[model samples]
Target: MRWRSTLVAAAVGAAALLAPVLVAPTASAHGWVTNPPSRQDHCSTGAVSFDCGGLQYEPQSVEAPKGSMQCSGGGGFTVLDDESLPWPRTQIDNSVTMRWQLKAQHATSTWEYFVDGVLHRTFDDHGAKPDAVVEHTVDNLPAGDHTILARWNVADTVNAFYACVDVTVGEGGGTTEPPVDPTDPPVEPGDCDVAAWDPAAVYVLGDRATVGGHTYEARWWTRGENPTTTGEWGAWRDLGAC
Candidate 1:
């Protein structure tokens, strides 16, 4: 009876030791920029319909050691470093609001924003956990085509999440279609031999619609999203003036 009691006690002790290991949480996926979509955001959202490899599925997994200058964070997603790829550059004013979507609300040290390889703006978190969604307003961005590299530095870990947004700031950068003049008569439906975009109508990939005297093709399925309001990486791709 004494031996049986000893065996039972030993088994319970072992189970206690293994409990924490069995229930240990795995590392969660991190974060990425969405609005004025980052390269990975473009890949994951089907805004860029190219072969972005595994990055297309795991946009929030571009984690690497701190202090990387490359857009991929010197990680495995090298497709983001390709300059020749037709990355859509979002048109914006000199001041823009950047938005980030987080999968794992990490305790952050600092949020750094860089433009054209120069540090532009930064937000200090003081080693605090961030919310699922973060927004920062960056001002006085250089007026031209530029790449904005955003870094999310983790407070507890040596790793950081990276995102790169290509943008055409202010005027005279990329060949964007000129804005429709306010004095021009409002274009009627069927004016361009294409149906005017209807917010109530569902649009899928390859669907064409006319709006604001210009034609647009849907890059992916969308509804209730106006074509003119959607930026370069949005669901609609501008097909120029009618």
Candidate 2:
């Protein structure tokens, strides 16, 4: 009986020691830039409207180690590192307001912005948690086409989230489109009169909602997902701007 108890205790102790190693690491936070639209954002939102592999469905999953200059953070989404793709460059002034939509929030260490491989701006959180929406205004960016790499570092982990936004700064940049107003009436007549999208609303297949002056139809059951953020391969299909 004594020997049996000892063996059982040893096995239990060994299991406890191996527990942390056996479990896989996962991100405590997930997010992406949406205003100017990151690479994954464009893929998820149908702005680019092309196949973007798994990244299309998960714009917020680009997590890797804390220090990488690559757009994808050298993570599994290697397609983001490809510069040849027809990535849309948003036209903007020298100063731009960057916005991030966080699917999950964690204690943040710092938020970093790098422009064309140079560190441009940084917001240090000092191990504080963040809100669902985070915004920062970066000033004095040089003119012409440039890539801004944004990194969100978690306070307690070595991992960080990455988003790349392409922009043409100053005059003679890309075509500038006016911002959409949610209060504006539908531009197209017929079938555009739908309820506004509610993040709390549960939607089934074929359900429709209007958001950001656009209409979207749910392709499957979904909840808590913003219609504008869920790109082309997401649960909602774009019905064109209304």
Candidate 3:
């Protein structure tokens, strides 16, 4: 009886909390940063961004007020831009491709990338109906820890989609220390052989495999090669020699 009562109470509480969102208007905007990993991107991919919010469930819905290019859109998401917070930073090379996933194409004015408050590069899509997948390459960013803001300026509307990506530009591409709970029981790598890093296997971001008594997760899609022999750019990330 006690357990049932507790469960009922918890259910009621949760329903109450979600009541607003469940009844709220359907969101129209749909897009998010995909490469170099915006906060919402990290959450979408099963990685934690430290100070994340309920936006994890609806990353593409993070819409900011028009004319405000701020990260987090100005409210309920500014934590994404909160420098004081310990956001997970993905490692990348100085030159990286920034990509965005738009659920629907829009006439774009311009797409801009900014690093440390300085404009790095801009892709002019003025009057162009961009594809759902938008990409641009940014080069010459000095190697170091940095935050990037990718802004999508709409041609017709006064609004823009904003995403902040935390990064570390190192010599050999970059790496990301996933913010998995340290308190969770450590996962043990099985006896999978190092040969498990099959060259013919096509891997994608967030894919995991056990190899050589350690667990290695794929940072990006790869196939047909031994990553251990490759340099840091290898798509594999070693969990440890467990």
Candidate 4:
């Protein structure tokens, strides 16, 4: 089997915009927090993660109790909510960007973000289906130890997907990376999967496939489009070094 890029999946890029959820995610749906690698990611890949119950096998599908928003998805996945266990934290500063890998896009209600239990920002996308790729930013965060909770609430269904990113907000805002303006020149590839860039293949948000021996991740839905083409709405992201 050919290996695809992982960055577009988990532990890849960072996009921040989630909020309090009124419902839980459905069982059929799939997705995960790719950037800054969620707890499930660390367990699934044997990386710098701690205490992730059975989430290693299914990082994208952490089911919470119906109609309830929870950080620790119900069942064995409760390891995500284990406060005593050290979940690897991402180093970040004010005004952060986050990337999400949503395998099954639904009619979304709204995406939200919480900084240390306080609502900071929200991205309203109700009645609209998201692209193959999704991203957002949380601006003006207080610099300190913060638990960032990002939630994607589905509109039609009583469900939501949850991703918790632990971060240390720093003092220098400029040091933090700016959100991806797909229109701006593509930023240099960080630690991404290696593969060739394919323009003819159809892709969805968070989908990963290898081309030319290098892996390129889809930023959104596209066909017959090159990943290297720079634009705010560009469709592909290069994952460095196979």
Per-residue lDDT tens digits of candidate 2, residues 1-242?
99999999999999999999889586444899998889999999787856899887889999999999999899889999999899999989977889999998888888999999988767667676789998876766777999999999999988999999999998633223323335534434325689998765768877889988888887656665677775554556778877
TM-score leader: 1
Each candidate's root-mean-square deviation in Å? 13.7, 14.0, 18.6, 20.1
Task: Report the C-alpha lDDT of model 4 over 33-92, residue by residue, as the tens digit.
Answer: 777667667777887545455666777776453333456544346777777877777788
lDDT minimum window of 10 residues, candidate 1: 172-181
User: lDDT, candidate 1, residue 221?
Assistant: 60
Off by over 4 Å in 4: 1-27, 49-51, 65-69, 73-76, 173-242
| C-alpha TM-scores of all predictions | 0.61, 0.60, 0.58, 0.57
Query: Which pairs, if any, clash in model 2?
Result: 44-231, 45-231, 46-232
- Better model by TM-score: candidate 1 vs candidate 4: 1
Q: Rate the local accuracy (lDDT) of all candidates.
A: 0.82, 0.82, 0.70, 0.64
Please give the distance, in angstroms, between residue 175's alpha carbon in candidate 2 and its true position after superposition. Answer: 23
The residue-level lDDT of candidate 3 at 72 comes to 77
Residue-wise C-alpha lDDT for candidate 3, range 1-242, written one tens digit per residue: 99999999999999999999889987577688888789888876768746466666767776765555567767567667667866779888767888899986778777778887677666555456877887776655667888888888888887778888999988643234324334434544543553455544667766666665676766655543354643343455666664
Residues 185-228 of candidate 1 have per-residue lDDT tens digits of 33333338889998667688778899989988876566656788
Clashes, model 4:
30
Query: Which model, 2 or 3, shows the larger TM-score?
Result: 2
